[model samples]
Target: MKQIQRFFLVSLTALLLTVFTGTWPTIFKAVARSSNPVYVAQSLNDLAPILQQLPTSVRDRLTTFISGDELYRQGDAEGAAAFYRQVKPDFEVSDTQILEPIYEAEALSPESLADWQQAQLALDDDDEAGAIEALQSLVDREPAFIPAPVQLAELLMEEDEEDEAIAVLEEAATLHPYSTEIIMAQVETLADEKEYLEASIAAREFALLNLDHPQAPEFQALADEYFEKFSKRRRRRSIFGAIGNLAAGILTGDRVPWESWNSAVETAELVELMLASESEFGASLAAEYREQLPLVEDPDVVDYVTQLGLEVAQLMGRDFDYEFYVVQDSVMNAFALPGGKIFVNSGLILGANSQAELAGVLAHEAAHSVLSHGIQSFFRDDMLSQFADEVPLGEFATGLLSLQYSRNQERQADILGTRVLATAGYAADGLRNFMATLVAMTESAPPEYLSSHPNSESRVAYLEEMIQRNGYNRYALEGVDKHLAIQAKLS
Candidate 1:
């Protein structure tokens, strides 16, 4: 008996060694066919020592299968399905019984199942509002249940609550980042609303996240088609905007505010004002403003901000000589002038938790300069007319400070800034996270920054969606240590 047992132990050890060395077919089949499959599945962790011996691809598939099996046993059929689908190509078990969970319907609790049924009943009765409310409640309680939010968003869309519907889908996407169904629903909704840019982004994201999916090529093609549509639409809007601005300027008798301002101070003169000479109109204005405001003269702090700003500005496709200055104010605020002159408040630098956050602000301000938003605002508002025949430097500076961007312009800057941030290799979510910080900071009263740059929950949601859709590297360099050092210097 002892000799027989020793032989059996030796055989088992050899079998495990073979399995670890890429000879897993036989053992896998045996495990699948075992009468006590649950026991075998639960004991998968015991093979952890040998798992590392397998190739990374094979190891990952095996681990994914194990995770799916665990979820299946825990009655999370939908969750298990997602995992199983990912590894289905690799794990082809011959035993039907072993793979039963993959094909099983999702198991919901009694309360959830009843609620789902009630929602269906409401839909059948033509009570759309009731159905939507029920579905909303279901999703609120069981966010992981993927179907509820999708159906709820559809209902909300039918109700003409397009923004709210998009918000719902965005929240669902956040909960199930890997759910192809959820992403598809989001894309379709956005397309229905003619939000071609966002739709194209969503479709491209699906392709990126599910590279091996058979439909990836189809989605990629769809993304291109939508982007083409978006481009055409943008061109049309630009022409219309130009015509509208012309008519407005003619009617208001301020036909060339921006052109006049530009002629007053050439771009080169503005650069000189920011860099070397203090005799130019813009430079002298900047000097006067410095006298009124507390300016940070710390060379290290100023150089750090300037270099970081340059890094982001370089990728903005603009040839402007971008310059950054630090202010000693304690208000969380930053702004950009007509040229590439960006001012950063020390309070903003201190408030930022990481270098990425500060970089986000710089990128946003640079985008404003690149997009010529300030000039456009000045033109549209006929800001120059508010001044005398010769606009005083102080009044001009004050006008620049008081420039308020429209919601559309702010969104444009946000989108461009996020792209620049990601391209510059900072965490892509830097701006989104900064917005979240601002939201938290606004519990008492809105900050000075929020006054100029609007803050809303939806803005943060859309930013997150953009980041996820574009597959931007949010885990890239955050520069926390460097940020802390700078903060300490300011302190």
Candidate 2:
């Protein structure tokens, strides 16, 4: 049992490393990637989600350490060790390859670092005012010091001075428009204050700056929430006017076909509401889940998966900017969020007999998004149309992704996805082979893939019949060399 667990753990680690590093053999290469301001900026943005999972104090100090190089260069290992000891004494700066470029992109001058240290000391001594003063002075002297304003804003917010905190954030945002910290702080504060208009504007700007960021979808959700709220406010006023008209006998004519009229109006309203926020809301929920999952960082695997998804998407007859990612979970599962984002577990990859099997799974999930089964399965019309219009997106996101669809929806996705494989020139037997594999695994714990996608003799029979009826090329493409290479690396 211990050996089994250890094997799984090592496999998971290998998959996790695949994301940030290139191939497995190159993982220990001593060279850092070429660094420029643009690369550093993007790298820091990518690191935001990981850093945010840590305790706030530790995250702050770690950010400072990454931005300043004096500690290691000046042989202050003792001092660095002492500083890290406060958080996790066992922590070492061994990931210097990752940190080198960030250090090279340091914009914080030595004086600013000194002020930051002083502010930290003041805060440690319980001199709140002194810390604020020092941080404020640092911000003033070095407007480009991204952390100073953030620290100052945090201090202000702690004292219940939210307005001042927002002011500091706004100034910081102007100075560093691409800084995720500043934009998030300002947007969240404005949002909490019900300043939805301003918040929406800031969130939009943030989205444009960080389109590929995990936080980008969250900002989209925020903007949609604000828009929904603002729209509903106007809707309520219009409702009142309609009520007045009804009271005045202005709309007294009775509808002969009440069902037809109601259905049309309801459908229109649902369409409008969906147009208002569903895609962004769904994408945001997926983004949040992504932060919780350890993602594979290998560009090669990511590109291969994404390229396949895009091809399947093209075959779906829709133009979706599909995003594919690998999750470092042992569960053999693949699921799609509301948007085009799809996640496949590493276990699924290693378990697949061929790339055809993997492509079949991806095509199936992509079909769910293309067919809007996720949206239809999760939300009821009236539930989504409350005058408040405050959809509990976060509450439903993970649940919705895990929710099983109706038999009809499942069948449609299966047929369509199988057809997509054929259309994309992959073996039509991919889905059939994969489902057979799932059925064979029923003796042990069932794979999570079978939870949402129930496998049965009938389903496989239908796939076979469909393949015959359509005369799909069952032997076109079975797998690729890259898939075998990836499996070897993971092993």
Candidate 3:
């Protein structure tokens, strides 16, 4: 009985030691030697999931680590440490790597090692003013630091300080001109402000400057298209809307579209956009505007729409001193002005549910600005007197723009509108939903959007495809939820 007890105790001690400091292969061999089926199955289950995602190189490294860990488990701490120290793989400077922890440990080799990290910490601290100041300095000094200037621009822009943000970006642009980011920032900001007559020309000039480069063709086309579109919209409004509004006013003593020549009717509309956007440094000029039409004026509705308007306005560029006028009309009419001025009819204001419907309006107006519709309108009407009665555009030039856009221009604005809403973290789907509702509503009632927009269905469909292609998650209003509730206090 004493011999049996001693033998059993010896067997238990050996089993426990085997479990402590050996590789899996060795441990399993020992277990197999002991004929233990359950331990092998348990080990396989533990490793299977982790092994599945491993690439070949990772799997190789993992095999070594697993071996070391197993050895440690079996009680050979020194041996385990030796194996772990030997297991790491060497990555060369140019090695294209996956996003594993090991790979991220060695990405972009930029200067200013701690500056960006510190900047991020400052940003997360919610001291946006301080964050902007610090980041602006870092960007000015390094210029090569991508994250700092971009974040700085975004932060300042959000705080309604476009001029400062634009200045910071301009400095960054000097270092990274060909970088898509810098170029887009400079050109896109100008476009957003309705500096189009100039902006379009500038966009073209930028393309010309880079003509020998890869992006030249696309940029050139965008610039030219913007210029020509503005020229034509101005021309079209001059021709059709000119006598149309004046005659309507004369024909009906009602407050007509254009009260008198005090405005030029066509050109003044464009000019109005410019004047409105004047306060917002980068958001002024003869840009296009579009938004839902309100049937009546309510301060509560105006407040809601203005909040949304300001949100989208900042996304287009920066410098947003804008106003939301509650026009008491029901034609679903809204328009944009240069210098951050927005005119919203009561009809349009009350009609918007989400920001997209408003975005649709804003983007359209932005397109107008980008194309320089106002300045070009002056050119078109030749109030400078370049042509006669048929408004200079007449039957001949109308064939070019045709008082409606070719599918390309309409699609471009819709695509851009979708992008604008998405960038602002607004619900882009709201535009699509608004379109569907409008279409359905139009079936039952008169459709104001179509008479003006003409391509509502296609625009909505395109927006849908865009959101899917870009994989934009619907907007998260958690940041604005409280604001929305407080505004709800108005009602």
Q: Which candidate is the best by lDDT?
A: 1
Candidate 1 local accuracy as lDDT? 0.65
Model 2 worst lDDT window (10 residues)? 25-34
TM-score of 3: 0.38
Candidates ranked by lDDT: 1, 2, 3
Candidate 1 vs candidate 2: the TM-score winner is 1
Q: Give residue 284's lDDT in candidate 1 (0 to 100).
A: 58
Alpha-carbon RMSD, each predicted model:
20.5, 24.1, 25.4
TM-scores of the candidates in the order shown: 0.46, 0.45, 0.38
lDDT by residue for model 3 (312-354), tens: 6555533345555555565565554434566665455334432
lDDT tens string, model 2, 289-380?
Answer: 77778998876667767887777767764355677888877788888876677888877877664456678889888877766566555442
Q: Rate the local accuracy (lDDT) of all candidates.
A: 0.65, 0.60, 0.48
lDDT for 147 (candidate 3): 61
* Candidate whose TM-score is highest: 1
Rate residue 313 of model 1 by lDDT. Answer: 84
Q: 279 in model 2: Cα distance from truth in Å?
A: 4.3
- Please, what are the lDDT tens digits per residue for candidate 1 over residues 1-491? 77455544544643543343222111222222223332211424544533444345455655665565556556675676576556332222222211101111156666776778889999999999999988888777667677888889999999999998988987776555457778789888988998786676566655644556888887778777876676566555544544555556556877576654443344323323332321233345556677778889987789889999999988765456677889998888998874577889988887675567789989988877765566556545766557633355666788778889876567667777888898887767778767766776576677789998885556776777777666776655555444544654575
Ranking by TM-score: 1, 2, 3
